[model samples]
Target: MSWQQIQPFLVALAIGLLLGLERERSHTAGKLPAGSRSFALLSLLGAVAASVGQWTVVAGLVAVGALAAIAYLRTSEDDSGTTTEIAVLVAYLLGALAYTRPAAAAALAVVVAALLVSKTRIHRFAREIVSDIELADAIKFFVVALVILPLLPDRGLGPYGVLNPAKVWLLVVLLTGIGWIGYIGVRALGPERGLLVTGLAGGFVSATATTASMGRLSRTVASPRAPLAGALVANLATFMQLLIVIGLIDGDVLRRLWPPVVLGAILLVGTAAFVYRRAIRGPREDLTTEERPDIEPTTASRPFALRPALLLAAVLIVALLVGRWGTDVLGPNGAVLAAFAAGLADAHAGAIGAATLASQGGITVNTALTAIAAALGSNLLVKCVLAFTAGGRRFGLGFLAGMALPAVAFTLAMVMTMTMR
Candidate 1:
């Protein structure tokens, strides 16, 4: 056969060989049904059948399925899984697919190999790392996002002309999803990975919440540095969530707001890194016997909370209406006040409100940008208060040091917006 005609067979052979190698390696003692040679021959058979005619391909697939069934029946009752049998059929299909879509077939082959290789890790993760509560939460999350979300109406409806059930629920899902991921990261990876992972994940769920948790930990722990480090990382998630909210609601506002938000975020991250280093590594503070027990850092609980996410969605609607009213009665400046108020509860809500206003032409992009900044400023202030009250003087002071530079950056960005306009 010409080289062109033989190309599909070659591709199929390679795909089978790659998957077979992984499957073979996975078997430590009991031999698997298919090895490299067996898989390669199956692939070649499939390719030859497909090259002949449609009927030939169907007949070939049926023959392979029959063989797989026979193989399954022959295996001892103790060997319950159908993985090898399934693999054989998939390999055949992939071989046929290689004739038409070589690139796609190759990618599928790689994915299949990876899955086979990850069997041990996946089993270990399910058995040891994930808890029953976590599994149930995962199912709940999927049901909300995949099942309930699709059933909700996408268009705005209901009282006050300010509610879109689908949009609101989607946001709730988004927030919950982000928080859930963070929770998983903290749970599976543990605190050994430190603040970088914990902080970011917690921040995604709720930066302010993370800040409060960290601050409270700092008050009790002898070395407040680790908790403080995590609090700093959480700010990163806060900024990211803000950007995400803006982008989803109004891309134009997002573009306008990104400059200041990004700048402030960078400054906050830098400050956090500096504080974390000093807190964790700096010279020893002589802790008395009584104080020593208080100094050890404690673990922060999982971050995601569904009820709070629903409350945030409620707050977003309130902010939108309040912002619209402010624009209608008091003009653009009033919208800034509304944003500040909304931001005290959740900055993302205020941001979404401002972006909605901009999208409707009630305010300019500059006004929306300013409103978002005001909201962020208000949120930061709240976090600061939480730090002082919950963490006491020492923890609060340390947090202040980390937050100052970012606060300045945000102020400058807001001022710049006014000047540029």
Candidate 2:
């Protein structure tokens, strides 16, 4: 027999064993009526019937459901949940799915087994850990990102082919999503570690938004020090990402760029370390305390700041239009200007553009380096302005101290490189 002929049955049997193992464990706990043997048979039964015809799978379902119903009726009152019966039905369907897509079926079976194992944690989190408002915000973010995002047109709209609704909405989603990420991190690791972790992760997504989210969060916390550290840590991702982009697109540009980028990154690390040290010494609300305060503690206290994200997106939309219109007709020199325009809001945007153009031989390496510097400089200024605007003086001052000195070093390095020629 061909491999294709035997693959589905073999895969179905494996999936059955995996699902059955979880059920068998539950059965030992007296919470489930089905065991490893029953689940394995059900999966094999599905595979055998589905092999016969599509309609045979339906017949298999009826027979399985009938058996599951009988099992349910016999289950004790204390353990009277449809979980086992539902699993039985799902195991059979997974077997049927394996007839065509064995890989997808196997992957889903693992997820199902994991869910079974995580019952206690999931119950506790849903019942106790997550607040009504936090859950609601999570649902809203999902609806926007998953449901609404895909529905918008992908092409650029409005003036200068700059306003792509989907892309713009994605930025808005990103802003809100960064906040959620930080919130979850804080919940998992406590305030100081959480913000630091999420800031590093969020920077890869959108450093500016991460900075804004952290800055805005600084207002709620007793000390801005931790959030300030998070905001500064996010810049580390900016440098690393630029290096990756430049290296991939143009090696010469990467060589030209790495010095200032490295210098700036080293400075950022020292600044973040200093801020984090201060955060540890400062007064902070115990985020994971058992005693519930009237208000939530530290970072979780505020709802994901949606209004600011929307306003930032609005500002970015204008930047995109102005950037596009100003540089669209400029050619090579125009690309550099475009990079500056893009960099005003996004550190990587213009730098990537310039590097890509130089790689294509549209401009020289030195020109690409210049454009990149312009972009980075413009973006640094934006981050500074946003730090004050979103986070207040303490946050802003922390941001400036972390960012400004490194920026000066970067410019001096660039200028020194020039005069040497």
Candidate 3:
């Protein structure tokens, strides 16, 4: 081979050497089987052999494979088999010789080595926490966030005038991350504290869903106070959801609304705390032994399906179109109606649609605020209905009261502000 061609091979050999040396040091420290010098020699030899030609590369692979097989055969007969070390050694030689595809081979080598080193920890983690569903969901989430979101077009379309796939998916990511954190917290609390923590966390995850769950729990259990406290906590999640929306759509709006949102959150939290304390103090008998529902990080059963996302995008387009049409026909009231109608299934979509309209000068801040408020109102109403339908009369009444009071207060506050302004 020419000297020019040999340069790339030399570089590949150097990388292999460095990695093998690290592995060798680990082996010496009781974490591996071979030393740095042995690995380095193997790597250098592999690179030289590969550089020679196809026949030389084949010969090198066969030699390494034979050595690995012998090592494994010898060790397997012993109680302390070291076949893994042998396999790693073979891999190291192969990686070094992979000059034509050095990057891919090196990456594979690193991953294999990492997997081997993390064997104990990985086993422990599997035993302690990971479930099949969680694993599947994690993989699905990865596909959505990494694979799909990036490929979508980041531009607007249709009449009412705003669509950005990147931004929308980004919002989805933000919500999923927040929901996942809350789900973890709830799961960690377990069934004993599940009701309270789940309710609070659920609010962050999905307040409406939490309310429905708690309402059902209340009906069979007869713990009015538990449902009451849970309901309050769930509403607190609504406030949080609004804050999240503001943060996602427009930070400036959040900054302006901070005072009211903070005040509202503090009141709701304090009320929930007081109710929780009272309920706990009253009776241990009231608490039942139902297993805590495993709250998913994301509400969607299927993790961010493209079909659903596309459907939502379509809905946003319709909302924008209707909102624009409403503004022209019924004025600001039409836009508010449009937002409320859209918010029925997705507050995030509604908020985004309204914000986009406002930004484009097609709607005023008051109009946007009204639309947001209406959407939230509709969303809360849906949850109330879900609680009643899914949970029963006892659960429904308690949940409705819990949700309604705060919602009413919020509505009044918004109305007064708009009027005063």
C-alpha TM-scores of all predictions:
0.87, 0.70, 0.65
Instruction: Look at candidate 3 and give me any clashing residue pairs.
Output: 27-32
- Computed on alpha carbons, the lDDT of every model, listed in order, comes to 0.78, 0.74, 0.65
Worst 10 residues of 3 by lDDT: 295-304
Candidate 2, 309-411: lDDT as tens digits: 5655665565455444544566546666777777886766577666655665666777677778888878888988889999998889879988877788888
Clashes of 1: 4
What candidate 2 gets wrong by more than 4 Å, as runs, is: 192-195, 198-228, 237-306, 328-376, 382-421
RMSD of 2: 6.0
Q: Write the per-residue lDDT of candidate 3 for residues 202-280, one digit (tens) a residue.
A: 6666676666666655655536676667767877766776687676676545555555566667767776777677677
| Candidate structures ordered by TM-score, highest first | 1, 2, 3
Q: Candidate 1's error at 66, in angstroms?
A: 2.6
The residue-by-residue lDDT of candidate 1 on 167-199, one tens digit each, is 878877887888888777766775556656767
RMSD of 1: 3.8
Tell me the alpha-carbon RMSD of every candidate: 3.8, 6.0, 8.4
